[model samples]
Target: MNIYSDLPDSHTLGLEMYQLISDLYPICRSITGDGVRKTLHVLQQFIPLEIHEVPTGTQVFDWTIPKEWNVRDAYVKNNQGIKVIDFQKSNLHLLNYSIPLHETMPLSKLKEHLFTIPEYPDWIPYRTSYYEENWAFA
Candidate 1:
């Protein structure tokens, strides 16, 4: 009666999906940037995806497109010079749409911008400041 009942084993399909996710998980993706382009390119290998690059300042509805923000690298180091959070390890370490900055600040000051879900302390949250003039790290 159900079309899904005629499909292959769910375990096999789940394994295949997990493999696909593992292959693509490391890509750094943002609303607009080379990361997004690279992600789409990888996805295109398995599926047909049409990508369009709208120029900055283009108007859509009542909002104008913001300039593309592409990050090559970002990190936060402790006062002792050990990197506590490195984007190279995971893109999630860097805040979305963060402007380029390199400065040494005390942990007390930095903590103000850090976010965490108390209910899931071990999990990192994906954050974005696409329209706000601010930055945050998860």
Candidate 2:
């Protein structure tokens, strides 16, 4: 009676893990948002999680809790009216927890805020400005 013998094969387990990642990869998770709640909800299906919520502006250590951010849509368009970056195509196109703003700026100015990984030029970098009041797109 070996419990190990009842487990799925390595290949099957790998496929299941990959499928789970694929399902969760696209979720727009942040420090606080429906995305985070949704992710926790999905995870709760596998393991019990005690979800807790602290009111905005609650003091924690040296910093006060900032407002929770959630974006429904965001994008940047060139002067000619073509979308240069669209959140719809990829959430990476928008910085996480970005304070919503709609403004037209020159490409040079916008480039100042853009971040990229020189080592992984083709990869969309994961970035966040949790404590700072700023935003950027990878």
Candidate 3:
């Protein structure tokens, strides 16, 4: 299947919308409680929304909002334990919903879950966890 078709365009209009969204992006925004409330407040100005929030441990369907994955930083080190890539430098460097692992592993073991795009191997692919436990570079 061609996944690129599902990707958003990076053209002029798309870029403009992206810039607008970026300008309004609230980093460190929590998904529950006040964070969500504040977001709804801002969103209401654009489109009225009835706010509803499920607490941290509530289950719905086959999924539950996993404990807010608010990561401050993460990174990988080489065999010598020297830092290779740091999440503080770029959030995409760490896998979202990763279980806060800090130990070092050989490349072979880490490769099992790592993801890379051949077109942009160095670029971190946007990955999110809404249902399952997974960790990956992409």
Clashing pairs in 2: none
Residue 78 CA displacement from its true place in model 1, Å: 1.1
Clashes of each: 0, 0, 0
Leading candidate by TM-score = 2
User: Is 1 or 2 the stronger prediction by lDDT?
Assistant: 1
- Superposition TM-score, candidate 1 onto the true structure: 0.81
Q: Candidate 3, which segments miss by more than 4 Å at Cα?
A: 1-52, 59-63
TM, every model = 0.81, 0.83, 0.58
Candidate 1 residue lDDT tens string, 1-138 = 788887769899899889888877888887788888988888899799998889988999998888787888888888788987888888898778877777777888889889788999877888888777776677
TM-score of 2: 0.83
Which run of 10 residues does model 3 get worst, by summed lDDT?
26-35
Residue 103, model 3: Cα distance from true site in angstroms = 1.1
lDDT of 2 by residue, 1-138 (tens): 888998999999999889888877788888777788888888888688999988889998987876787879888888788987778878887778777777878889888888888998887777887767786787
On lDDT, the leading prediction is: 1
**What Cα-based lDDT does every candidate model obtain?**
0.83, 0.82, 0.66
